[model samples]
Target: MTKWSTIASSLSPDKMFLMKQAMEQLDTRYDEQESMVWGEEGQHDTRESAHYALGLLLRGSLEDVQMASGIIDRVLEMQLTQQGEIYEGTFRASPEQQAPPSGYTAWGTFSPGYGYAQQDALTEVYRRFAQYAQLEEQTQYKEQFGRAADEVFPRVWESFDPNWREFIACTFAVILENFEDRLSIKQVARMDKAMQRAVSTSLERYVSQSIPTNTNIELMHLFIAHYYGHRYEQIDWIQHAERGAMALLDDYRELHSFAEFNSSTYYGVDLTVLGMWRVYGRSVSFRNIGLQLEHGLWEDIAAFYSPAMENICGPFARSYENEITSHSSIGVLLYLALGESKRHLTSINCETSHDLLIALFGVDVPEAALQQLREQQGERFAVRQFKELCERDLPGHNRHVCTATAWLSPQLMIGGLTGSHNTNGQMHHATAHWLDEQGRRYSMRMVRREVGQSWNTHLRGMTFNVETEVSRLDITAHLEAAVPIELVFELEGAALHEIQITADRWQLPGLTVQVDAQAPQPQVIQQGGRAEIVYAVEHRDRIWNQMHFRLYFL
Candidate 1:
């Protein structure tokens, strides 16, 4: 059997199902006339097209290969080739749009962050195209790929960020190790020069700075780079990587959690990078470490996942969206592990499509983790985890962070973090999920609001003392600054009789919330199919720094 088929045969039926479903989804997104995938917003995205091409290449039929080749040709044409320009080496964000020159500042705009084009999009194209050349039997495809490399390799030196630099270097290493015969002397020379630059720059950074553990996704990329550097006999890169990896492993050993703990989006990046190390690392020690970390990470994800609620219980350190149905990279892995019953609860979109690369390279999740996800029903459990935050400026001193007591029962799951130093406002410190009488899932969470600014929901320096029982939660929140806030209860699928409010309490279909602070009356705002019960907490006379509330599951 071919390598892809061999791996496919080894996958469990559920995983195979997930792979097939993902492929079909990609196929549906393809625009036959354009030879690319159109994003949800009706614009053509280069990275999304590259991911679709990779999926098609993996499917590996004659027609699929032809289509994938065409998509790749279109993607390569999108590269910005004007030398001396800021984005010269990067692909365009779209055919009509260039990345914002100011880098990450223009997020949520028509011209978005530079990383989408410069780092992530280019890396995806190069890695996926390299795999295509490796797997195709035809010599013409390999030659075309080599010429494409000639065009792209000279630009690798343009990437300066540690994570992006390492990503390009690792891809170059893979191409050199596997497809050296196809590359011309000029292409190889250019790639090696770029690779050396990345290595030397990385070595200097590692020597001068303490290795960071707080951003778990970027840490994995650095580890992968170190593994490749070691394989290619770069002594300093491997040394620092080994020391950093060992220290990170020690932290996980103590807490059974990551510093960037319980992130629904970034965990997928972590898992994929570990899988790459496990599959590609030549060193046995690195491979073993990857396996160990991957297994532990999977176990943590299983523990937090609620089968009844169809989502992971959070005190999410970072999350882009509140609902699993919106979009989650880890949701792809969960669907693979848990099977078709969860199909409706998970989402796969253009941005997360490249995560399918994990399946292309095999990832072996532990059987124990799989069992936990499958058998979580009718189980009542509680989890407490601790992690340390590295103060980048204050090297030696680390801040201790305690995750909230997560209580999971058959009908409900609730959790929060004791506190967070997250400045990006992605932290969901306290959240609850439960099913109503009609079996529709409902959610509630605490959010900070600036005085007179109801739309402001940035969570920063908020601390919580949260305790959970079988059907109740007691939460006391300490704000760093005195601010008006609200407990926003999402009532998406509720009927009129399912909600009732008294003076200081709220009665929902499945939950009763008792407020302890003097606050304004509750407001119910309806927007389309969704409604929110905004229970506001406002301080008038003096600056009260603390607020207390209780939740009882009915």
Candidate 2:
């Protein structure tokens, strides 16, 4: 096991300062919350906050540790109030007092959703707090911690859904291994029962043909089998786990990083879990393979880090907003905390946990890399490109798309194929943008297409070809159906200035023109440097099948 001292003394002064600042910022955020929510206000994810608290306790200062303890205690206290299925969360503020967040909350009004890490964290909180209470000679608090563990155990085990997430399963197995002996005799019996359930569920997931091909899930099943096989003395579990691990090794050899969306976050999550298996698994091969996977993932992720944005700049095949910091933080925690060797310690500032850096990744960054990062931070413009087949399963199988992402200093640009099969219609168009230093997004222009007749049914298998230059973007949309269509070009962003549009060879009768005879007249609506241009074309002609729109940003 790696000691915090080894990592601590080796950290650089500049890196140390940033880590401290991040930890202080996290502490201040929790302090401001009357009760902790998720990253944003009005929402709380059981797992997200739980993991945050785990990171805090593992790497936080004394005060931060105490603060995390209180947060976990509050969660345990909340868990105690439930009688039926274990609801994942509680609204710290009632709707009458503060409006509930719009759309579905994580578990939807405390429904017994997939327990995942929430259940694991609830148990972990009790386990950790009991240790703290014992250290302080607080018999009352120790009893309270134990009692809370018992209160949460049945709910966690009973509500467990095997089909949901593999990481949660890994957490569950670890918890049982660590704390099972400490429980009461009755609780031990309950733990045994839960183990049996996990084995059966895991087996089902392992052998199922229809399950998506995911590296993490596959490796997770192997780890679970290895752990429980020993506990239950089942030879079949061990054999299955070994086979599963070997299969993953083969896939990794071919794919390097296996197919998945949001490589930074998902890969980080998988690597952390693999680190757990490396520590827990008996087979040396599993650990060896895990380390190789770690190196590949780190190299890939580090390339995307833009010191200018202090975030993972993207041509992300599958992307989300808030996970950039969290994903990078998970990597720092796992690699520095557990890896045998501390090679290049790059991308330390990307994580938000100062304590994690000092305790896990290390307090010191390499002088040369640190200098380079600072130098890049001062530069005005930068551009990056990723030209590879990024395979994803969301829209379909073997779905790898060629995409490009560029960072023009404060501006970030991502361009790629539009999502044809997207049910939500969120990413149905080609988009590119740059974020100014203020974190405001500015796009040159965005083109969205709407087919008037049978649009929904006709959308299947459609494709868009986008050609882009330094100062211009041309989008040629192939809509095979001869249906009326409208192309909407929205120039959006806070940094947009002096917005103006002039279309050539296009007739504009208030932006209405026939699809065959003339290009639609561009209707420009401008307000404060943000403008929307609407073009309507509904003529029956073969040319309408291929509609082209060009825009220039000066």
Candidate 3:
């Protein structure tokens, strides 16, 4: 028998029984209440198909392929009608029942959210499949892609739902454009620019009005419209999307905007960051026009499923600690980038709100957190976000993670460095790197602490920033504190000398200067003058306020 089979058999007599049970559930093919959330909009089966499909891609088991392929088949089979309109909403109900607007579908399962659609769900199916098809068999892969190129695009073109229709059509258009490029090359047929404009215009109108968006329905259309607008030089469409996206970020607060909420952070702050990402950080189209939104959108989409990443994708997402709510972590990350965190944000399952604060944009494990992930990963998937972190960046910046984009920071990446516990489960997410000015090196250690509570409720009250140069640095703290214990900073180096400290009168009481190996004592100095050493106590959580420093030659 194979190692997996032998191992399964040895580990538990019930392992085979469990697999059998899963197979039985597969046979029954009953969707859970949770699954219904996705399927209700004709989008469930496709996304599940995508999920299983991704698992299959990683493990590459034939059973996985068949399972994923069959799910995709079921979704395709349950088409609203061959007429390419009127879709199922998980219950297998007919069009007549959906039309009355009972204000509830499934007796209360769904809010008739984002309305109904036919092509949008299937287009998402196409999106997931396309990502999977790369590692898939070229023949069958090409065949499924061929269906998307041929049958799907035409149906998308005919659809009535604005968001899903536009999105699916755009997806199909992108495929056609790509197919022409990859399989057969001829002078590309020009798209109907007016039709494209219509797509983005509708979507932009929806977001501009702060109308319901971020569902399978709205996201699909929005994805298509924004992506293709840029592709075909549709400036007005881009401008329109930009304006609406900006409003969502600048004006909308989760506490104030009841509409700005979702099951996953991906739809809320994540998407907010995404829209912001597309605008400011410049997330470009990886493939077809619409998919720029998918990757960026999906990045936000999957934040809450960190638990799933634990259960499903393994260590790639294991870098997150148990204390941080996925939503909270997402909120903090966004605040680090956006300058404020939205309130009434829901907590992610298997996460607490405290964990969120520690998960800022540039935060990392401090030797203690890593051990926990390893123990968990060791038990399950042997996951390694370290490899991921080194390649991308810690805490997923404007780029997400290090590996997903580029190595973050002037700090050389943790090349080939992995995490394991030393008798105790203490973990560290940092590497020893030289902080230098033309090869002069000083060690910089980043640590995370959540010791004090801020009187201010805004997350801006809880955040701080520190930057290091050759011999000088600036520290900024955001707080509305009576006595914010600002983090104390100093250079305990051998080559360091003549480190002087100074601060404004208001900040003077918070200062205690301790030069190399000196005592931690308060010092008085004129504002704007250099100090031999600087000891500072920043009150917890504030933003955009800084203590300046001017270094002198020894």
Candidate 4:
């Protein structure tokens, strides 16, 4: 085992600080918030959501989890809905009492990622202690866990808001995933259908967005969370994975770019992969999708990695050279395809997508082939890299998941409980994942051929590079600048990374550098005819946070 329990340190110190910054953006109950941005009050998510977070914090420290548990029980008592369903949230305030927010509330909710890390922190602590449910493991931790679970377990279901079904699904996924982690297979097999029903129903409802599922960040971390849990056995989760792959493949074949395949977005194709295939490992059909995509049928998704890798040809051309490394839904499906088809997907560049293709093809490719592929990954790749807003939390270039969320991708984690806004721009999408994960030292790599800039009127990128002997991270550019030239940069400080933008260029966004404390801000890194510009800081710990920019002067 890896010496660390992921749950215990889910939230890095840096993340905790960012969350504090975000919370500060709001008008908490402690503040009257009379003159708030939306000219309103507390946010929509703070009511019952705070309790879960608060309970977790208190549960870890207080010998008696009872205080939090009692509060949880009281909340559950509010759930008039039946055992398996919810129709509303536990916390309620008039719309008049609620203020929307000054900036995008969805983005603001994360502040710097404290709220996000807090969840992981609480979860880790609780899971570690949960095993003491016998109330027998007399460690101080056990007593606290026992008290918390005892009080909360009985009443949590009641407190869950029906309208917040997405959150419910997220909670259920965790419960199930943790149960699997702690219980025997036989024990897991014994969970009644009612539980599954609850999960599926919640996910379906969440994807549909018929209710309030969103908590923040491109819908929230639930999207990534959905993928980590165990796959379905009694059900057809594998089939779902296969179908999603096929549909995406089919769409990519018809459409030149994956950016056009909006169906999978709503259907939660990635989510299904998590819920049914990755954990369960049953989706035999999905293996083919990677094969098809590798065949170069869909350029958009392929652009994320494919031709840029070392492999010159697609997976069909070679297999042995490419190696897939991701545990994501797409990665799992691609591996399935490669194993079935015996193809290899090598990196046209460093992206896992290219890795997926190589795994699918299964061949030893020529170095020349990879060189040729990179040569071809020109402007289209640059544009793909350029069309982003900038995420401050993502340690590197990911602002990845969506073309829509762009820079906000850093706020996204790998689960389904997190969702994004609808086309109408409402933060209505919330998801639930299929698994429970622990640990966070992450490294995400994608392919980019620096398409240089010209006098095109809009600058496509800015440079943000950092490579210390201890830490390695960067957010560079591949500009396909259009009307408004935006200097893109990579910002990493806390544990995560994000993208940052300087609005008018007059006021350079500046802040204290976390990595090299001696590094002064507003210290004249000229861009957009401005001084040092600052970005959103997620946490103050992890003293290595830095922002590297790629200036774009179109």
TM-scores for all predictions: 0.71, 0.51, 0.27, 0.29
Can you write out model 3's per-residue Cα lDDT over 422-480, one digit (the tens) per residue?
A: 11111112211222344333322211222233211111122323232332223333323
Query: What lDDT would each prediction earn against the true structure?
Result: 0.59, 0.44, 0.30, 0.28
**The candidate that achieves the highest TM-score relative to the unseen native structure:** 1
- After superposition, the stretches of candidate 4 with alpha carbons farther than 4 Å from their true spots are 1-3, 6-194, 200-245, 256-276, 287-553
- Candidate 4 lDDT score relative to the true structure: 0.28
Clashing pairs in 1: none
Query: Could you give me the TM-score of model 3 versus the true structure?
Result: 0.27
lDDT of 3: 0.30
TM-score-superior candidate, 2 or 4: 2
lDDT per residue (tens digit) for residues 367-428 in model 1 = 98888778765656657576645332233444566765677877778776775554334556
lDDT (tens digit, per residue) of candidate 4 on 17-50: 2223222332132222321112123332323332
> Can you write out model 2's per-residue Cα lDDT over 1-554, one digit (the tens) per residue?
32222233356554444444555555544533534534544545333343345445444356545555545444333221222222222212211122212222222233222232344455456546656667653233645664554443433333332333344345445435543443345644554554455555556534532223345566666777788787788888888877777766665566444544334545555665566665667677766666666555554444444444444443343332223444344335433432423222334332343233233323122344344333445322222322222112221333343344333333444333433332112232444455544565454333434542212222222355555444344567654422245555555555344444456532221122122223455676666746566665554443444567564433
Model 3 clash tally, residue pairs? 41
Lowest summed-lDDT stretch of 10 residues in model 2? 87-96
Q: Is candidate 3 or candidate 4 better by lDDT?
A: 3
Worst 10 residues of 3 by lDDT: 420-429
